[model samples]
Target chain A: MLLPSRFSRMLEVVSAMIMDLLGIPPQVLFGQLLIGLINGAFYALLSLGLAVIFGMMNVINFTHGAQYMLGAFVTWMLLAYLGIGYWAALVLAPIVVGLFGIVIERTMLKRLYHLDHLYGLLLTFGIALIVEGMFRYWYGVSGQRYAIPAELTGGYLLSFMFLPTYRAWVLVVSIVVCFGTWYAIERTRLGAYLRAATENPTLVRAFGINVPLMITLTYGFGVALAGIAGVLAAPIYQLTPLMGQNLIIVVFAVVVIGGMGSILGAIITGYALGLLEGLTKVFYPEAANIVIFVVMAVVLLIRPAGLFGREK
Target chain B: MPDAAGSATATAPAPAPGPRPVALAVQDLNAYYGDSHVLHGVDFSVHEGEVVTLLGRNGVGKTTTLRSIMGIVPRRAGSVRFQGDELIRLPSDHIARRGIAYCPEERGIFASLNVLENLLLPPVVRPGGMSLEQIYQLFPHLAERRRTQGTRLSGGEQQMLAIGRILRTGARFLLLDEPTEGLAPVIIDMIGKSIRTLKGLGFTMLLVEQNFRFAQTVADRHVVMEDGRVVDTIDNADLDRRMEDIKAYLGV
Candidate 1:
């Protein structure tokens, strides 16, 4: 949202200093940094959903990637068949996919509650494969383009780099969504119910809260967050059935590094790791893809519960 | 041992004068945890506007009885009539909405929530529940520590919070499991005073306790259980006469 003219002079000096220090061209450094932040936004959004689901439901949601893919596909479908724009699809996709998540939770997930955690994992994993397979069959493996909205189609030229309005919009929206969700779960009365239920569901139910219904709704909301990320990502990445599957493995690493079931941890780690990956891409291109996994391994060895997660 | 069942009608005092209607009645209550049978035909009743205690040794189904009444137990088969509503088939939340509240033995305070949040956690089902101001007035210490995380409070404060949580739920019937367990003597006295205050407010309570002495102070009747069945019922007024018998049943 920033005006390029007002910040260009300040950007000139800062860009010059960073370029000199890093011994790199100004465009390459700032371009990679902006790309890193955009990627970070997605990581933050996806991992936040994973953490919330795991926190409340005690289920490691392997279907999150598939859900993310569904969000993007739904958005594309809305645009292709119904002439819906990106803005409208952005609002509608999450709701559509969230309802889908509710169906999954009520029909399949609820039955596995009394069983072992492994059973839930296996069930969700199986569902993810089926969902991804079905989508791939319908859409084919080839990538489809989703045009950026007209309002956010252009870029702002700065002294350091050209910033896309859509990337800035994505970054701002996800951050707001992430923190807004955190506030809702951690500060509100309904959040109190959720936290209490997370601790002891039987006791919360005895207090007259319908916990099973809450679980269903919670799963829906978490999947809906992934839907938001997917819609935001549609214009940036090619819309492919395997898009969520590819990003989900990385998101899982982020969740682990941030700590399972820790909301703030997921967010902070997602962004930090994204920036770190961007830096790796700049300095050592060979390590860019594996940097996040290396961090996850280190975090696991040092703290199994995650950096922010409380020890049980 | 003296024959309690055979001599019950011969030695038992007549129902107390001006007996109120039964608030809760459990008949032929049977409960199981997985494959293990915990309660075998357990039966008890608490009259309205009275405090009753279930007294037994460890693992003797006192807690199980309370849980079964609350419908928190995994499998229970019995007729638990509350205000003429059959509760054995209702879910725990439904049972709670029917004005039954349970304060678990562990206090069930959330570590992530502050004291006020814990107190306000239970939804008020009826119209007459205590307000936050009234609950804070009852436990001034809780008011002082309102913003403190629930688990950070002392054992006594946590117990008070648990009780206060239910009090705000407007549920007239309370099932308190070992409220004074592991508390200091002073805290126990404070809890006893709170119980008396709750009773004065006309709240019916079914307390499960191993401490018979504490039960004697707050309860109108003590239903003694052994091997998951009620072995004897001692009125608080006649507790002194049957202290040795009650002690023998409690095995303490």
Candidate 2:
């Protein structure tokens, strides 16, 4: 978090600049922008996970939102039942979700590869429903409070607003995770195998790489990204079984607009769209939700493959 | 003509051999692609340092036989012994790691990876594999395009890159399928020269090809397959005598 007094002065200059240039109240503009950035952070994380899985396996994991929810719930459960705190849960929750994802890949998702991609989509959609339904059955629709850890409870006072520490942390960590995953996939030897497998799995196998295991792990890694997003979101959003239900559709939009095949595309699209949504809320509150979809439609008309997607 | 009902036929016509040192031996191999059985009890062998080519018409299961050996195609029943190691039960990767490598018919180069990256992607499978510099020296054009992605290279360059990529895996046994399928005659000669170079280096190879002129340039012996069975083996020394028979078997 920004250290109060000195940080407030710098923020004041920034907010003043934004206000002088845009003719809007600095407070309202900064607040909305910050909210948009936080939302973008989550969107980037979720869509990145989906893109990675799709890149390697060509499976659109419909269960990603549920997996994200599981991350939050798993965090809550660990804290409530096992007395495990945020620090430990941060490390454990993603691993738990990733392993669960691997299990899903082996028992359910792997069987769908020989058929059409539609089958994998349908199967993951089914799994998402099952997982969300099970959670709702047990927890009910009402949300529960997940307290911000003591270390991250408060916010730093800026000139125009208060910036919450946890939100800031989430933004930093999300950026790190997205870039880290990108680096691992694009720069490493194992990444070459993954990319090659994505292109021609049969040939990769002939080259002596274990393509199946790599696919399984790619799916798992993608889910783990969702898990991390959920953990970061738990304290920010109410811990409810229905948390992931609505968010997934927006994430799908993010993926489609970004290019499901391009890692960097997804991250940038997520943030840019979020900012546009935020700006729309300030200018025309009624159109806030629809602006992203509008842009997506325009992009599709102009470039059917998406901003970064290659021709099939 | 492959004699029907003859299960195990040795067409080696060895000069002095009881059982010459075998580098790769396939016995009664059967394979399937979904419900269609491609190879029906196929048998072939490559002794140490031998450049044995499988020549036949299209869809005769010569490619299937190479794939089956590498475990890319599922072998229903067979014994594929590579350097005395049973390979039927192993996966393609395991088979590849055990001193054997494949240069597929289509030259499976990853479009996204640069030439150097593709060269380095497969692990130095053992100690004797060629180094990046050695591969570059062999295919100097690839050296100029080391930073270029695999897809952008021309057809001949891609073929050269594909062949050079496997040479570094330290695999002693190389399975080359149609290495000169669509190349110009000059390029074909270069490939033939490389094959001869590899042969002189003592690498055991099983080549699947249709170009008799090209195959004759690199192979020590040519095994002709008809309808998924080895019909006859012609020694290179006997090529002039058996030209008509080889043509009749190949039906070219």
Candidate 3:
């Protein structure tokens, strides 16, 4: 073997030390961080929906992932079949998906209300399987890419990081949606009624709330939020039928780690865990796949109710 | 000794007769749980401003009657008319919006919500809602624990919170089940006083109680049930004479 040059060896050692100390190059690190934030945004939105459904309806909504995939597919069909643009699809997707949710609630979910929570979970799981299977049969496992809209196609270079404009828009839109939902549930008069019904539907009905309608609407709204998240995610990820499947598992973990105690808690835990996963990617690439699960295990050990969950 | 007090009043003549303007009317009401028929052809009516107590032992259908009125349980056949409006076909929430309120035996308070949130919940409608000061006046203990979560409240405080919450809804009629169950004597006394105060305010009440002594002090009329049917309807004037029968039926 040829002897290595002393100066080249010295340079290699310095760069390796720098990489170890700084975790990763600034561009790679910030890029991953940005991606993490994007992932966090979706996580926050999806988990918020799950928490809302769980709180008021006491349904795990295993169909949530399927509904989210339906949102993306609906948007695609709107564009391809109806010549609708992204903006219109953004508004139409949720309404269509929400109405679908309402129909499900009226027919299938209504029957399971008096039964065990497991039955609801099992029913929704079967729904998820049916939905996913149908989509796979039509679209196949290979994902189709969605072109970024002309208006959102540019990018901005900041320091060493180049941020895509569409990604930034996704970040901004998701935060607003998440906070808007949180405010509706936490601060509004309607929210009070929702909360009351969740606690004691019988008493709330006596107060004239029309609880069955409220239950249907609440489930619809929660599903609509997931649908919104799906639309936002369509351009960033491959529009595959399997897209929402993996995301939902992470979101469930985020919900458990957050304790599903408060809406705000679910959102915050989602983003925070997402950022931690990003950091893990830079420092220990091997752990990136399950950093969220690891964090969930740690949280359960420390506080079984979750970080924000109240101890009974 | 309490039985003697009831008999002393029993000999008095029945108070003024004839149906007062009906506040709530239940005709041939029948209800069931799965295959078990719990309420059968139950008939009763409460006049405006009247305090009617449905008194019976644990399983004699007093609670079921109140639940059926509120549409909490499924009614197989019947007409429940509240203030001349048909309630049997209406959903529970719609029935509630018509100005009927229920305080369940479980004292269903939202344990996660603070006392003030619980009180603030029902009176969301404008113009005739109960204010924090009014609820405070009714149950000062609730006022003290306004910021406290519902689970932290004592049983008496939870009962007060439950009643106090319904009062805020501007509901003209109240359905209260076992308001004094599992409470200390002092707390029960406070609840008794609150009921009297509420009666003084012109609120119509259907109180279900196993505590005959407590019911005796507050009820204007008593309807006793056995086997999902009303066995006797005693005016306050006749409460004492029926004590032996009530004691035997209630097994108290």
Off by over 4 Å in 3: A1-20, A260-262, A297-305, A310-312, B1-19, B84-86, B123-133, B241-243
lDDT of 2 by residue, A187-251 (tens): 88878887888888888787788888998888988999999999999998978987998788899
Candidate 3 Cα lDDT to native? 0.83
lDDT of 1 by residue, A78-99 (tens): 9999999888998999999999
Q: Comparing only chain A of model 2 with the true chain A, what is the TM-score?
A: 0.95
lDDT leader: 1
* Candidate 1 global TM-score: 0.96
Reference-based TM-score, model 2: 0.93
Docking class for candidate 1: medium
Q: DockQ for every model, please.
A: 0.77, 0.61, 0.40
Note the residue pairs that clash in candidate 3.
Answer: A206-B96, A208-B97, B6-B240, B7-B240
Candidate order by lDDT, highest to lowest?
Answer: 1, 2, 3
lDDT of 3 at A192: 72
Please give each candidate's TM-score. Answer: 0.96, 0.93, 0.86
Worst 10 residues of 1 chain B by lDDT: B1-10
Tens digit of per-residue lDDT, candidate 1, span B1-252: 122112222222234579799999999999999999999999889998788999999999999999999999989997999988899999999999999999999999999999989998999899988888777767778989999999999999999999988988889999999999999999998788778777766779999999988998888899999989998999899999998898788776
Clashing pairs in 1: none
Interface RMSD in angstroms for candidate 3 = 2.1
The DockQ score of candidate 3 comes to 0.40
User: How much is A197 displaced in model 2, in angstroms?
Assistant: 1.2
Candidate 1 runs further than 4 Å off: A1-7, B1-17
